[model samples]
Target: MPQIVCPACGAINRIPPGKPAETARCGKCREPLFQGRPADLDGAGLARHITRDSIPLVVDFWADWCGPCKMMAPEFVKAAQALEPLVRFAKLDTEAAPEAAAAHGIRSIPTMMVFRNGREVARQSGAMPAGQIVQWLRDAVLALGS
Candidate 1:
């Protein structure tokens, strides 16, 4: 079973293989696990998702005041729509979570990080189109196998 951490209530849910996780709900919160959209997470929520979830976690570190971040928002959403069930997408507002940003050593807005098993596996700075983001994630996942 794959363990998925619920973004809403931080509960861990076990999912059987070959099951469609897109329709799966959190056992504790009863919220849909995969909403086909990026989940907005605070610092603690980010930590929990990264560490607890069995699926790879892709986090977008951004700030509301950043023009590039705003421009990349829709692209990120599109990427999430294409990548869900294979990966989990999340967004953290750097302005709201300065400590988390600092902890991640994020000096630029619109930074993306891929985490598996609570550790960072890949990172990219700057905004990218949806296709590029999807490609980047696919490449990263491939690299993990190597």
Candidate 2:
């Protein structure tokens, strides 16, 4: 079984392998696990997601005031749409969740980090197009096996 942390109610749900994640709902909250959209998380929420989830997590640390962050928002959404079920996508507002940003040592806005098993496996800074974001995540996942 794969353990997934629910973004809505912060409950941990166990899902059987070979079952499509798109249709899997949280056992406690009844919310879809893979919504094909990035979940907006605060500091504590971010911590719980990263620490508890067994799947790969990609977090975009952004700030509202950043022009690049705003520009990349839609691209991130597109990427999330393409990458869900394989990767869990999340976003954190650096301005609102400074503690999470600082904990991750994010000095720049629009920083993306890939985490697996509560540890960072890859990181990329700056804004990118949706295709590039997807490719980057694919490469990161591939590298994890090497």
Candidate 3:
């Protein structure tokens, strides 16, 4: 069995083998495990997702005051819409979670990091369109051989 961290409540849910995780629900919160959009994360939520999620995670580090971050928000959501279930998309506000941002060494707004098995494997800093994000994430993940 594999464990997935619920996007709704940060609860760890074991996924049975040969089951479709997209249709799975969190036992603790009874919420659908895979929502078709990026989930917003605070410091604790970011930590939980990074440490506990079984699937690959793409986190966008952004701040409210950042113009590029605002511009890329919809594109990020579009990428999430196309990549959910197999990959998890999340956003961490640097303004609100400064410590988390610093810990991750986020030097720029709208930076993205891809994590697998509790470690960062890929990182890119920029604001790109949905198509580019999806392709970049897909290539990075495929290269990981997961």
| lDDT agreement with native, every candidate | 0.91, 0.90, 0.91
Instruction: Tell me which residue pairs clash in candidate 3.
Output: none
Question: Against the hidden true structure, what lDDT does model 2 obtain?
Answer: 0.90
By lDDT, is 1 or 2 better?
1
Tens-digit lDDT track of model 2 for 17-73: 688888999999899988889999999999999999888999999988999999999
Candidate 3: regions farther than 4 A off = none
Clashing pairs in 2: none
Look at candidate 3 and tell me the lDDT of residue 79.
95
| Clash totals in order | 0, 0, 0
Q: What TM-score does candidate 3 reach?
A: 0.96
What's the C-alpha lDDT at position 78 in model 3? 95
Q: Which ten contiguous residues of candidate 2 have the minimum total lDDT?
A: 137-146
